[model samples]
Target: MTSAQNIVVFEHDKHYFTEEQKRLKLDEVLENYYGDYSPFFKLIRNGVKFNQYVGVLKVGNTTIEVLPKADGNDKDTWRQLLIDMIKTVWGFEIKVSSSADLKLKSNSILDLYFELYTKELEYLLHRGLIKRYNKKEGNLYALKGALQFSKHLSQNLVHHERFYVKYSNYDVNHKIHCILYKALKLINKTNNKPDLNSRIGALLLNFPEMGDIKITESTFDNIVYDRKNHHYEKALQIARLLLLNYYPDVSQGRNNVLALMFDMNRLWEQFVYVVLKRELRVTDFKVKSQVSKEFWRSEAGTKSRMKPDIVLESRNNTIVLDTKWKNLYDNGPSSEDLRQMYAYHHYYKATKTALIYPGEEGKMIKGKYSPIEGNANASDNTCGIAFISTHTDIVIWKKNIISFIKENFFHVIEEG
Candidate 1:
């Protein structure tokens, strides 16, 4: 794929994973990713549909493959899938080139990510350079530093506050710096450094040294980015999201698979959110992705959180929809799936809720199910079903989902 060394690219269709690759085992994958006892394991164990995007899997102790799941010469199909999945899964946008020369090994997803992340990080370091006066503290009794003036006197038995003023390293700029630093370090650990590696290497001197602020989701929260200092928000978001590609506690010398892997379930949930958001009409309904906070079973100290993939809210009603990137064969929807949708429906106080799964076939399929059937008492058509094929175009897929909503869902609110 594109003459790139140490990189393998494949389509997002027709799993070509060898028998040995299929048998590849990772204890952390099942535990941290697919849940310790998740029913989704049926697919992972079978080597069927594990994740949504064309991704990487740790085949051996050191081998990693850039997987493209959508098979065929249709690079557009796979590229569109990657774009859609990335936007939804990671809250960032990537500028894509549809030209013939697929600059970062057209098929290598990881390489493309590195190229995009490095480019944006470099730009921000150059154009969005903002620094503010900051105060630093240390335990020096010398008069050389800005003296604390007897402050923290008894607390500083061995250490007094030696304050100094300089540029603040705790700003968002430093957050971007650390993300790039850690990402570069991980790339070297996983495989040979690609062409983009050198580009990132060049930008090292421009960024401030972030001492020990660990990068996590909270790093981007409540961050102020207005007209004055808003120039680098895009780069900061890209850098932060790229750093998340790795599993948090990936072992130093173990297989890099865990390090470069993303959860398919999580990816599909977000992918569906992106597609639906684009297709829906903003005037009638506002759509939100990963709607766990608006409704929950318990919100106290007990630690129980329920997050649905997409929530569509309108003046008429609020509908909660869950997306499952599973192949719903003859078995149809499972009981656990039904129970989850029921909870969303009850808590949201909405008459309409749904379970959406990839049809996994040639054509689109839709079903309206009262999953909790036979219990006539609860059989008010509270839950519906939808199936969108992986191959459908955005325009057509949106129409299908919206039509499903109109035909099956809107009636509930209208009648009430």
Candidate 2:
């Protein structure tokens, strides 16, 4: 298989291509995707502009990886940050090495997942593939196990040498192996990294060839694990991500696409929630993400709910927070965002509401919501903006965020 051409860009960055044909090829993929779902990019005059979604998109042999960039950081920094965030949010245990022998420089997010899957496979192979007793039905040269008399008689009457039997065979050729093997084929075709390809080839050689099984949502749900075979959990999780997201272009060869993208906004929200939940685990204050309350209902029972990105509740007080992935330099929060915060404060009965964003420095901007009747008195309901420096070391980033939250919303957290 031909190697893919890797291209890297930051979120909201416009990539202009010199080749007209290449741009057209990507356009075709984007057009088809937009028809069925939301388009990830907009077609410009010469190229495309990526939106807030960041991850890998492979169109034909060209792979485009969009990395999240904030506070004027380089691609590698953001790439690593994105990987860490994904690991925390998705609950994936990924091992990334910077050793001289490996020389994995500036690897894309997809490569990280690909490496994870391969590593899981290697571990399983080392432990030996698990064998499961499968009920198999086929023709055998001799009578074995239970004979399928109906099938044996219909086909074997002319050919007396053949005996059809239904037997239980204990082997690796089962659902788990089938899923892993299928994912191996997909990675071999989709991955462009030279180091990973050789590993995949070696794995396929050692792995038993199993017949293809049609995969569906229930395919994974039907799987059961015991102490003996529970190690397959990690590999199957990666397989689910790869196999379920694989899209083939039957009309054109080598034009298939695999998109492993995540919405930056939702990702930021989840990252904040996960990190806060980690930081506040020992504290009395409880951190929850997307806490919903019914807002409106129609006569037919159609209802709309309001969900705040993060909510910190203590025994006596509640603090509501919303996270924005983008920068808010000199501009203030949008009226819409402020309005949403107002609703969260009012509905949640929160003592405070704040918007958390990634920033170059720790800063706070405090504002108050107007009274319901627009009276002269100032409203007690307040919304503040807290900026956590993204340039800080990733090790201390979580603590820095938690500290900033506690300092800004000191009453609700520290005093409550």
Candidate 3:
């Protein structure tokens, strides 16, 4: 629709609004719909007639439709790029789905997830391998059990990778089956999708049902991925990811939308850390994430901490860098970010410090990644530091990060 009322905006593109109607809607998202996504919308500046940034922002009832960045041969969609970063950076922030299956009918993240989840389960079904894990439980209803108690415990006895028996609460397949059940319940409560809900609900019953499983770190701690346990792990992960996206029933409200949103800030940090690990692949250089520097000691002991996003340490030198997902514009980084970076340099005795942000070429003054940009807050007032950028291109962006480290910090020495 070419009508002003029906206009849709996409992530990472500029939208110039000549009408006050659209600006009001953008502000509504900023004020009202800003749930856990406050930081993301902050990246979208509400200018006089233009609001622009990366990522989707829903206005009223519709999710902002992102304009295609390229036409032909650039089939790498935004979701693919997003998933690529997620896989490389966190490695565990995904479920099973092919590239074709990841494309969305709508701009909504929730819609995309439901599609992926549905497809993944379907794939598992077609392969005939969406099996459950066998776990033993006690029962007295069936006298043929593992062990019968002194008569009070009727259901506290049973045993193996058993099948076709009564639902075992301890079984992982049963646990995962229950997770899907619980997620389906949550999804039903929302007005997000009705037909899809019906489809998922009907399909869910096809699998075995069990009592709700309390998912915890310990729930999966003992699990080891092997040939036998692979299917269960994949399904369990899908269930776990879905389970994490909702709040407890007590916290739910009338206006709050049950949407699953991931923080891109942490994603960017992890992405940089992963890429830098590649650049510093030499034997001498060691790259660590969240390397803590304890600068304060009290009765509590080592309470104050300086944990930068990345720490690159050689035998002689240490360099610290922090990743900011924000677009710094002409103003560069905030003073608070600089202050933290300065503290890192002071406490860790870091030879270099950098505030790395998402890069759009020609947007800001490109500075050398080297330490030649003298730190204003240096202990000696002479150490080197600079602001760096991580490009948006998937292939080149990673290489850019790797090269940025190699060219700026890594020192080569010739042996005798």
Q: TM-score: which candidate is best? A: 2
- The candidate that wins on lDDT is 2
What lDDT does the true structure give each of the candidates?
0.55, 0.81, 0.53
lDDT of 2 by residue, 42-139 (tens): 77776788899998887778788999877878888888888878877866633321112323433578888888788778878987998899998899
Model 3 ranges with Cα > 4 A deviation = 1-83, 92-108, 119-142, 146-173, 184-206, 213-235, 247-256, 278-280, 300-302, 362-392, 412-416
Arranged by lDDT, best first: 2, 1, 3
Ten-residue stretch with the least lDDT total in model 3: 66-75
Clashing residue pairs in candidate 3 (N, C-alpha, C atoms within 3 angstroms): 10-65, 10-66, 137-158, 138-155, 138-156, 138-157, 138-158, 139-157, 140-154
The residue-by-residue lDDT of candidate 1 on 76-114, one tens digit each, is: 465556654664455444343112222554444555566
**Which residue runs does candidate 1 get wrong by more than 4 Å?**
1-54, 57-80, 91-105, 137-145, 148-194, 205-229, 241-258, 290-307, 343-346, 360-378, 392-416
Residue 245 displacement (Å), model 3: 2.1
**Alpha-carbon deviation at 188 in model 3, angstroms:** 8.1
Cα deviation of 177, candidate 1, in Å? 3.5
- Considering lDDT, which of the candidate structures 1 and 3 is the better prediction for this target? 1
Superposition error at 233 for model 1 (Å): 3.7
